[model samples]
Target: MKKTLICGALLVFVQQMNLVQAQDWKPVEGKIMTEWTEKVTPENAHQEYPRPQMTRDNWVNLNGLWDYAIQAKGAAAPSNFEGEILVPFAVESALSGVGKTVGKDQELWYNTEFASPKKSIKDHVILHFGASDWETEVFVNGVSVGIHRGGYDPFEFDITSALKSGKSQVLQVRVWDPSDDGPQPRGKQVNNPSGIWYTPVTGIWQTVWMETVPSSYIAGIRNASDLESKQILVTPQVTAAQAGQQVKVSAWKDGNMLAEQTIDPNGTAKLTIANAEFWEPGNPVLYDLKVELISGKKVLDEVGSYAAIREIKMAPDAEGIQRMMLNGKFLFQYGPLDQGWWPDGLYTAPSEEALVFDIQKTQDMGFNMIRKHVKVEPARWYYACDKMGMLVWQDMPSGDMGNGWEMKVGVLGSQTDRARTPESEAIYRTEWKEIMDDFYSFPSIVVWVPFNEAWGQFKTKEITEWTENHDPSRLVNSASGGNFEMEGTKITGDIIDLHNYPDAKMPDPGIFGKENIIVLGEFGGLGLPVDGHVWQQKDNWGYQSFKNEEELLNRYAGLMKRLEELISDGLSAAVYTQTTDVEVETNGLMTYDRKVIKMKAAQLKPLHDKLYQVSVK
Candidate 1:
């Protein structure tokens, strides 16, 4: 009895000491922070399930504080770390607790310890990284596991073989991101952030997790719904499938099974729904999915998923003008150019609630679509949009800027595609494809934008055609206000987009509306910088600066009035300047910290409603 009591006391003491150590960490000071910043702690940084689309009960979130070190580029991993940083937040961010820059000449290293999750010999442990900037290498138990290159796509490594027989296992990560020094697709990261560009984010900026699975498990899930046939096509990528193994997919609605189909593990299963509900703005209907890997009479692995039925295309209206169609009907898509940056967490949001807050606020303003400008967001962001019924126009993060661009008002520019080295071209291709494949399952994504404003606009014809052919389900906006490549009568892609500031403008309906969908890609950048909610106090500027909210609203209403006329002429869609202020750009519906909505949703929603009512013809 005495020994047991002493053991219990010692365990309690150790746990108390651990709690004290965790409490020692705090967010770095001297920056604008969101409301969710206070909710972030080492114990609960991002405890939500990282991947919601394909969910399994057996997994562990590897967030919270981890030992971090900054060393010179190409240097070996350090034996000891400098300090603790909050996981999933970049080192350059205030939420990281060690807000410091890791430049192109340096590398960031992370170290953590987790208990082994394997219960049997047949179990394979997978180390998953939601995303890491640039190049990342992993080591498990001091053994090199794998290396992944890409700033936005998720990657995993099977570390089962590297694990030793122990209760605690060591995990280490090394990351190198050449923000602007290299030709990688880094979006707006710059060594010297000023004006429109923002700070560089290095190291892990997304969730890190681990899961144990059977030898043969479902590695990936690809879902697409056919509105015409009322069928849901499910393709399960099974890893190490045995001969005779099969996949069973079942679609359910409101806890009731709608349809089920069993097929070979390698093939696609088409489950036909009797009464299909289409997914659209204000009427988002998602059907639950259950996938099981079966071998004979035994079930190997099962996962929970979801799908939505929707279609996006372009069709000519009665006036012979191409109009964007949603679910076989013309709907003018309007939203803001969302940068997906946070004042507290540069790339990652302070918390999941904070991540969804921006989307919710945008929706409250009566916007149906969001042009995810340049930077890609975490998977949960898209999942939230899917649930909230928000349309997404995803853009490939631009890199290798300084390409010559000749801006023309209503005609094609004389400048051809940018001449990029083979290395730069390969990097762009590899990452773009991975990004598309990673986010293909999300039904919220309606458009794929390859280039924006001629930033790194290379191989326009080839890249746009590849993107269109790769995913025929979503419409491809080859270039959003970028250099256009003419092919006979029409532009290279489906949409001919134009970008104008302060005032709404559209492509000439008489010139290109007959061949492609015309859109105002960006406008209405009226700046209103709230004093306490800004990243910096001085030199903040917008395309059109407004001293007060009333003036901003008046200007915005005028732009909307003109936009309604354009929609009547042939404009299919439009994206406002932005959802939130970013860095030095003060033009946003909300401030940088998101504490103040510059214009109330109630006031903006009524004005935005009038745009939707305008006819597309």
Candidate 2:
């Protein structure tokens, strides 16, 4: 968007919030106990453009306060507004301004109006959403424009025809989320909030925005790099007359045109660039992509996109021990366990700064990667990792926990003993496919973990083969931890995985084999709860608790020191538990609210740096 449009949006938000007028705009009482949360506001909360990989200059940010109502699940839209609720913040979250619950059979409604600057015939309006949990029906000017069903990926609707002749317009959304009660992939949510599951998120928990685009625009684009060929395969989605249509892809760096080509739109187009910059941990390089969909002699549409030339895989070493490989070279991965939670926003972090802060802090702490646990994040979060050059192990959210479910059940040294039923298995596949499709674009994502410790483990052989066939370029993780499926369990397609809790241990290669890359999937969950920053008042817990920061730091240091020895002894990757404090889990390097970084980043980062050096060797 132009600076003027940005200023207009900011002005609207600032005026609406009217921080000076406390009576009109105040948070729902008893929900938020911290004064620091006031910092998360409309103008500042997650203001960054949500989709960084695919860039558009004229997109609007529709975060902040919107009118919300809770109604019967199948009820029609309400004629009147109820009260204000924050966009992107889950209904159960403190920052939502509603702090309410939408049960198994309820619809959460949102209504808002927005104004856009005038544009010419060459321009069109594009309505965008970061994501909507469960099913969503969107309307503009009282006309139903579109309906989106998935809870994970992003979707956009062209609303230029639905726009008003005037300067402003109204957008209404009706959302239905059955959460875990239905057979969708809802990770760790329940009707009842307890132990590991604390509260369920309903409705829009991601950003909503609008943008102006050309009538003939680039609908979508894909950048799949071929390290072996030293080129990138660009596929731009456009409005084409027939199946054999060809689109032109233009590449640029720092606004300087480098190469151009027209190729078949059926699959990826090979664009050769001699020794083009490859993105790695330190010097990450990204090239801008511009594609024009052509029909006869006229340009039908054009879109702006970007991609980096890089690769993430796992390979065996000289001794034939499996390890993580970046660009075909063994690079041991070390990272924190990113739970992807927020004290205020739940799945959605309150601010973009907070999202990037977690990544940057992870890098600062000396880790080169992150095991993004069970939850998929907004695109911009991955963009930050790309920019920062941190590897990511993406986990498919654990869908079903079977009959016995606890929010904080102790399973530290114990084994996970849950299996997915046939019905739940189908739902798991549906959600897993959606999750993979959403995050497959990111270059930072190195591995796809389908099952984690058998939380929803079923048909592992089928899921692994499907994942491997889906994205043959990247590696597939058969299962993260327990209920070990023996089909592809021994032959590691990506990383030979093993789980360790207090003391790190590798899976016996005699049984699981020295066939592929090996990694210590999880370890080092040292918990220390800071008094003011905890999610719960009393029962907040971790794998282990500490009374002071000194003890916490000491234990963490010892854990890393042991990991350093393990790294040399065939441990290709390790993930600590976790980035920060979750609802009841206190085992995080930082506190849940993100107000406190319990350990010094300078001390932690060096530990990871050494591991990366080992991998490079």
Evaluated with TM-score, which candidate comes out highest? 1
Q: After superposition, how far is residue 617 of candidate 2 from its true place, in Å?
A: 8.6
Global lDDT of each candidate: 0.91, 0.74
Cα RMSDs, all models? 1.3, 5.1
**TM-scores of all candidate predictions against the true structure:** 0.98, 0.88
Provide the lDDT at 314 for model 1.
Answer: 92
lDDT of 1 by residue, 88-140 (tens): 99999999999999988999999999988955789899999999998999999
lDDT of 2 by residue, 1-617 (tens): 69999999999998766664333544455532333467776556677778776676666788877888999988888988778788878777877878888876889889988885467875777788888887889999988889987677788888877877886788899988877777667776778776667678778888888877655556667678988877878876654335545678878888887778887655566777765988877777877888777665666666677777888766666666666677877677788878787766778876677778889888888888899887788998898888889889888877655633232123211234446667667656776776677667678888898877767666666778899998887788777754444444465345556666666666654444366566778887788877867666788767777888888877877876777677666777788888887777788888777777888887677655665665322
**Considering summed lDDT, which 10 consecutive residues are worst modelled in model 1?**
407-416
Which pairs of residues collide in candidate 1?
none
Model 1 error, position 198 (Å)? 0.2
Error of model 1, residue 69, in angstroms: 0.7
Top of the candidates by lDDT: 1
